[model samples]
Each structure stands twice: as C-alpha cells, then as structure tokens.
Target: MSAAPALASLQALFARAVVAGEDEAVLAHLAGDPETARRRLGLYRRAILANQAGALRAAFPVVARLVGEGFFDEAARRYGEASPPARADLNRHGESFPAFLSGYPHAASMPWLADVARLEWAAHESLMAADEAPLDFDALARVEAAGQPCLRFRLHPSLRLVRSAWPVLAIWEANQPGRDGTPDREEGADDVLAWREAGRLRYALLAPREAAFVEALARGETLAEAAGEGEPWDFGTMLGRLAGAGLLCAFSRGAAAPP
Candidate 1:
C-alpha cells in the first residue's frame, strides 16, 4: 500500500478503537514502550469518549435530564462507541440516538423516551436550518380565493413535523424550564410542528386534522387540496394558524406544479 493510504487507514483504526471503547491494537504501530503505549491509548480513549458523550448531552439535554446525569453518561459513552459521528460536525451527530434508546434494554422502562428524543431532534434541526423568506401574503391574495386550492405552498426549509405514537410533545413541554410539577408517567400521541421564523425557532403541538393539513401542504398540495383532505375543515382557520406561526414561508405556482 502507498504511504498516504497506509497513514489514512491507521488514523481510521485509531478512531475506531476510541469509538469502540476498547481494543487498541493500533497502538502497536506507534513507537513507545508497551506500558507507555497502553497508558497513552487508555487516556486517549477516555478523553475521546468523554468528548463525544458531552456532545451528545448538549444535543439531547432533555434526554440527559430525564435519564439523570450518571445514567446518561454511561449510555452516551456506549452510544458514542456504537454510533460515532459520521461527519466532522458534532452538531450533526445523535441522529440515531432515539433509535438507540428504543432498542436499549435499559431504556425499555421508558418506552416513550425515543419519541421525546425525536421531538428534541426536530427542534435542534430547525434551529440549525437555513434561512428563507416568509410567504408573501400579497402574492397569495392575488390568486382568487376560489383558485387558492390550486395554489401549491412551500413550507420554510426549517419546518419539521415530528409525528409520534406517544405524547412526545406533552412530555417535552412538561420538561421545559419554569415547570414546577413532575411530568406524568403516562403516554399520549400527537404531532409536533417546529419552524424557524424571523431568527427564532418555535414549536407547537398539532391537532390531528391540523397535522394532516400541514402534512399535505408540506407534500406540495394546494390549499384547496389540503383542506379537502380533512373533514370539518376550515380553510380560514388553517391559514390563520399557519400564518400565525409563520410556518408557511413560501409558495409559488411553479414549485407547486406536478414535477
């Protein structure tokens, strides 16, 4: 093998060892006494594990708080090993943490934990999403109200809806700062809508029909088409809710056309 590829492989192996939380056979390639190599690799492993766990904690504060700091620390360490960041940006890590929790035997006691993590991830993603212009009410008004059903809408790029079978939104809200009571150990189901508006990220729980409307709009359906999808539908109320949240940030005839 060429020197460059060999060095690259070694670097990858080093990272793998740290992520695995054990096995430092790669250290054999480095120049040092055996004892010194063991000491250095052990310290390196601990530091790397700690750093990755810290990043995970930062990204999933609610999860940490829910599980308690010590439990989270050990779990995060194992998670870092099993699902290490695939990208250089640590902020992009923890995408699979919810899945990890869902399968972890220890987390089985908190079956709704994964759903809560999903909600947090959506919020985190929205906060980091790119900026965009708000929907132009003037342009939308130009279209005849009758023709509005044919008008396709584009949600803000930062908009995300997290639908869960568990009452994840309630759980998340209950854990927010300033709440004085312990959250109930019960599960409920709903959808969470998250979006960035005017440099601020916000989230709200959506009613069943409302979630369907938002989903339809996100899928590029016309206002009329989306409204038709729900019974007892009120286009006025739907538009009002969307506009109030500033979640409807873009819509154009071209983007709405069947591709």
Candidate 2:
C-alpha cells in the first residue's frame, strides 16, 4: 500500500490531537512504548501551550497584566484547545481573544476585560496596517455642494476606532510603563482611537459625538452625512483634527477610489 494516504491520515489525526488537546491518538502513531511516547507528547504539548500563551501575552499585554501570568496562561491554553493556530504565523493568532474573554465564565466578573482586549487588538492591528497618504484637501474642496452627499472620505487604514461601554482607554493607559502614579481609572463610556503615525502608535479617548462622526466617515459616509451623525460635532474643527492626527487619506465618490 502507498504511504501517501497514511501520511495524510496521520497529518489529520495530529491536527485533531493538537486542537482537542489530547495526546493519546498522536502518541499511538509514534514508534515507541506507550508510556515513553506519552511522555514525549506531553513535553511537546507543554511547549506548544507556552508558545500560544506567549503570543497572547504579547498581543494583549493589559489583559495579561490584569489576569496575572498564571491565570492568563490557563486562559490562553483553553483558547488554544478550542481554536488552534490555523496559520504558521503566531502574530495572526488571538484574533478571537476578545470574543473568547467576553464569553469566558471565569472572566464574567470583570465586565470590561473584553473591551480592554479589544483595545489591545486594535493597537496591535494598527501597528501592522499599511500606510497611506495624507488627506487631499484640494480634492475635497473641488467637490460641488450638489455632489457633497456622494463625496466619501477615507480614513487611513491604520486608524481604528473602538467604542466601548467601559473606560477601556483608562485601564490600558494606567498599565502603561513610566507613569508617575496610579491613573485615575476614568470611568464611563468612551470612544478610543488608535492609529500609527510616523512609526509610533498613538491612542486617545474621544467624546461620544466625535466618535460617532469619525465612525460615520470611516464607514465611507460623505462629509455632509457624517457631520449630521454626531450631535454638536463641528465639521471644520473635526476636519482640522483629522488632518493633524494624519487619519484622513483620500476621498471617493460613492465609495469608489478617488481619481
């Protein structure tokens, strides 16, 4: 019999063993005494768990800090067992970590933990997003009033806006290094903005209205339409803010790329 099919079957079994976090099936495939094979697989499982947990720590620093190293490791292990890394790159792992935390029974008490995870993921993704050009003011100025509704503004790819019921920004900021003392732990709703500018990651907490306005623009709403979404949001002032923060990139008519 050809060995190709056997190899493929082994590969599938190995994946199941890893995902299910059980070693018996995979250990049986190894040519050794059952006890020795189990011991080796145990070591392999430990190493893989450590690696997966390490990635989660790097991606969600605040979450790890909040939960502490040991608890975080257990959580990461559980997450890995449920969802193994489908890709080789570790950076791509933990995309569902925020959602995992939200539903995790142990994390139920910390209602805002998931939002903090969201903030961390936003920061992580912003750093890796592709760079884009600054907003073209001239193009925006050229659009006629009649066509303003269709004139869509594009935010930079690296710009991420996170709206949360909890003050996640305050929690993240307090955990950051080099603070003079404990941060006030600012409470209440917030719209946290994260973006990479000049190779540095920038974060800010925005008011609800401003958040609404920016979110609308990010969704490809026209300048006129976006302005209407946020109560008391000043378009001219926001325009300057977008320019200063380097968040705006290009404009489009009906979501089509501008010429």
How high is each candidate's TM-score? 0.86, 0.88
What tens-digit string does per-residue lDDT give for candidate 1 at 52-123? 788888878888888998989888877776787778888877889889888888999988898888888888
Measured on C-alpha atoms, candidate 2 has an lDDT of 0.82
By summed lDDT, which 10 consecutive residues of candidate 1 come out lowest? 250-259
lDDT of 1 at 46: 81
After superposition, which runs of candidate 1 have C-alpha atoms over 4 Å from their true positions? 1-5, 21-24, 178-181, 184-187, 254-259
Q: Candidate 2: worst 10 consecutive residues by lDDT?
A: 1-10
* Residue 6 lDDT (model 2): 75
TM-score of 1: 0.86
The residue pairs that clash in candidate 2, if any, are none
Misplaced by over 4 Å in model 2 are: 1-5, 16-21, 144-150, 179-181, 229-232, 254-259
